[model samples]
Target: MWLRVGSYPDRELAMEMASKLRNAGVRVEVKEYVEWDLTEKYLLKGKLGELEEYEEAQEWKRYADIIRELIRNGMEVEAFEREFLKRAMPEEFEIVEKARSDEITDDELVDAVDAMMKLSLLLSSVYGFLKANGIEVGEYIQGNLPEDPEIIIELDDWAEGCEKVYYLDFVPSYEISVDVLSAIRGGAEIHGMEGAVVDAASRVLMNLIAGIDETNDIEELKNYAVGVIEDSKEFDADVYVDAEEVFEIMLRSLEKAGVIRISGKKVKFRR
Candidate 1:
């Protein structure tokens, strides 16, 4: 379970909270959110944890909100509390949907619970929906989400009786490793057969698209992706971009909007 604490002007500011939370023994993930209303850029991050119970999770979330409110707004804690509550409740709802894992992925992503409970359904509904409508979702992804859990409401094919439910890690395939991608983009090259950076990049993209699930990474996937490329018709004839090349191209594309930068394999994003 993750508990979002407060917004910061930069990672440095967020790190201040992270430092405190670390001292208090909490896990943290610093995420950069793209802000639409602000002229100056900022970031929002929450301390994260994987507690066994929801109550423990909520307890820490409350603690984080109090402490971060002190840090971000000083005496205006009341206002901070109000905003946090507004954000926290819905965020918790979002988190609950995401709690489900991918051993349960499918086209609809929602499991049908009942007609009135359309929101709680996942997996079977998506499969049934696409198949019936003659619509197609990707093999691995099947579909993408606006955020995690990626809920799709109203399936009258929308079967009112059955609702779609996503209840796990609900990860999407094709999420690139910002770290490696950045290194490659920062002009760090890797040697892979006679392939160019594009080839490596394509492999990386495939892994992301597949959204390989594991507590620890299965390195063999890299080899498998590479083998597929090697067996491809353009095996050695093209100046195939390696993973790094793809990273460079992708990051550069992102940079056109002032959202990112690559330095020595590090990715710093601004929005």
Candidate 2:
């Protein structure tokens, strides 16, 4: 009979422990165990309601309410001019009011709202990516959005009276680096050499592993992995990777490596 020696929330750490035990000539089988009870589940449900997307939606609604109140008080752009710039522009205040009153008919307003929504989602996703990569926002740099996928960040205090600007273009490329190849190989090793697929799914596997700790929701993780691959500049342009295929391969590979175990809708890391 195997005895439970330890439990870990971190999948990578659990895998490391399993590897060490196996190397010491001790039999080890990493298994997933759920310890969440009713109270924990209730807490998690409450936390889910406070997610960033929900917060952002609430913020927009508040802005709309404020704009409507300003219109009622006979103050339009003047109110925004005195206050700090919110996510929406001053001119968008009128648009918001018009939208709320069902008076919005201009295609331009529709396009503006569409663009704003897209930009908001893009910024949120990029922030998460930067956080995962251990990059701190407002540390030494400030981001300026001139357009979609083309962000220019100004780095402060680089040298004496010298300002450095870094341009981050979230566009896919055909070039693949050696580091990416190594990551792909590492992912493949989880399920043996023959389990590897040299397509787009293989590329996504690398990012999926990196973002494993970001979320326990497999569907969300799969979407994030796909989005990362789509925005990456290191993807091979010639290869086609399916999102569904990537999710399937990712789950199988991680499970085979004893890094994770899927039970119903929950994915628990081996401990």
Candidate 3:
């Protein structure tokens, strides 16, 4: 038989309680004992000595509700680990205060969780698009979220079917270290031979199509694009364009004015 020091209806609260208790010289064993719903569950996260099968209690729903309320209000899950709650409940102390200088704040943890949830939904939307295009999508490895909260998505079976090289990172309206960008582009240039070829081909075609004089030879266009790309590589290619809104407006205007029209497999442009 084990002594029950505290009982939490959710795993988050239970884990915090166990951690705090252990810090304060208490021996406790924590485990999830019941599943109530996809989001809410009763966890038997306190006690010492014995591990036994436990069923959901009548008051489990009430405890779960309390935990959920705190979470919804943007409170850190560790807020439950406070000393007052430990002493007032009698069921749960002088908390062993650990240095929190390196620890992330409760607010930051909440924000990170919120960001990940939104990112998951966005990824689901993209999965739907891929499935619609007859691509088979499978479960992806979801590693621990980075501290900075950036989503890195790698798609398979799109266009190049995993044979193409593409590297693009969006920092979400913020500036990132130029050193990081340099490293990324350098790595890209090394492993992106296929991408370079593709880019060169597209640039050459655009140049020839938009030229004042008509050029019908594919070989000549390829040579020109290669020369231009190689020549331009030595110059600073880093450019910051703050005209995203302006570009959006231009795109809408072009669509409305029919300056560029897209019809299945064909794009018509006004000369």
Q: Give the number of the best model, judged by TM-score.
A: 2
- Summarize candidate 1's per-residue lDDT along 1-271 as a digit string, tens digits: 1223344433433444444434333344566655333122221112234331223234434434433443332334244333434354444334333423222221112221121122223234434333443334442212221111211233223222344443333321111112333333344332222113333554554443343332113333233233334444334553333343233444454455455544554444453
Off by over 4 Å in 2: 1-199, 228-241
After superposition, the stretches of candidate 3 with alpha carbons farther than 4 Å from their true spots are 1-21, 24-102, 138-271
Of the two candidates 2 and 3, the one with more favorable TM-score, higher being better, is 2
Ranking by lDDT: 2, 1, 3
Best by lDDT: 2
lDDT of 3 by residue, 153-172 (tens): 23333322123434333222
Pick the winner on lDDT between candidates 2 and 3: 2
**Which regions of candidate 1 are displaced past 4 Å?**
1-177, 181-199, 202-228, 231-271
Q: Which run of 10 residues does model 1 get worst, by summed lDDT?
A: 107-116
Compute the lDDT of residue 110 as modeled in candidate 2.
44
lDDT (Cα) of model 2? 0.42
